[model samples]
Target: MGVIEDLADALARDVLEAQAELGDDRFYEKMSKVLGELSPTTQEAFMTSVRVRLAEKRGRDFLARMLAAKRSGGAAPQAPRGPDSGH
Candidate 1:
């Protein structure tokens, strides 16, 4: 991966770890507050980057699970990494 891809992967991994630690409710709460404070364009860009990074690192299935967990306010399952945390 290029430097930007590597950075995006790192960011996705961090977000996954953090969401697991915080559980869905708190994670969504924090994200909603932060996103609400951002401008619409910034929010769109941020969410797009986040989704792309997550989909790249963990696959569409994982991204779906993450979104489902967030919507349901439940804990997210651990990332399905094979080795090196799939980074």
Candidate 2:
């Protein structure tokens, strides 16, 4: 895989591991809070990236929960990869 792919894989693995340790509810929260804070266009990119990451992590419910959280509040923490967050 290329650099971007590797980064995605690594991040996905980390998310997966974190989710396994933290459970779906918490994991979803962290992811949602983190990504949702971005600008609309960035939110789209982040969501897309997150979907790819979650696909690698096999966190299907996590993704659903994030979407739900996008409408509501689910505790998704801002990951360092985001914009305006020194990511």
Candidate 3:
């Protein structure tokens, strides 16, 4: 990855860790604001990294749930629905 991507990825990891500890779901937004003060390019990269990491985490969680359900001979778990999902 390029310098911007590398920096953004590292910052995204830190933000995730902080959010986990503080239980503040809006931490990413706050970080975005701070990055915006630095530069629009940096802020955009950070936001993209943050979003990708978040989506990955959600997929991991869903996979774990599905695995657990399968082990217990239960029904397969449903994928999480986003606001854009009509279901």
**Overall lDDT per candidate, in order of appearance:** 0.60, 0.57, 0.91
Candidate 2 or 1, higher lDDT: 1
Clashing residue pairs for model 1: none
Worst 10 residues of 1 by lDDT: 24-33
**Cα lDDT of model 1 by residue, 4-81, tens digit:** 555444644466568877766236335535755855444444455567755675677788898999999999978756
- State every prediction's TM-score relative to the real structure: 0.39, 0.34, 0.86
Model 3 residue 2 lDDT?
96
Question: Which is the winner by TM-score between candidate 1 and candidate 3?
Answer: 3
Error of 1 at 62 (Å): 8.9
Off by over 4 Å in 1: 1-14, 25-33, 60-87
Candidate 3: give the clashing pairs: none
**Model 1's lDDT to the true fold?**
0.60
Alpha-carbon runs more than 4 Å astray in model 3: 81-87
| Candidates, ranked, TM-score | 3, 1, 2
Candidate 3, residues 6-43, lDDT tens digits: the string is 99989998998899789898799999999899798999
Residue 47 of model 1, lDDT score: 54
Ranking under lDDT, best-scoring first? 3, 1, 2
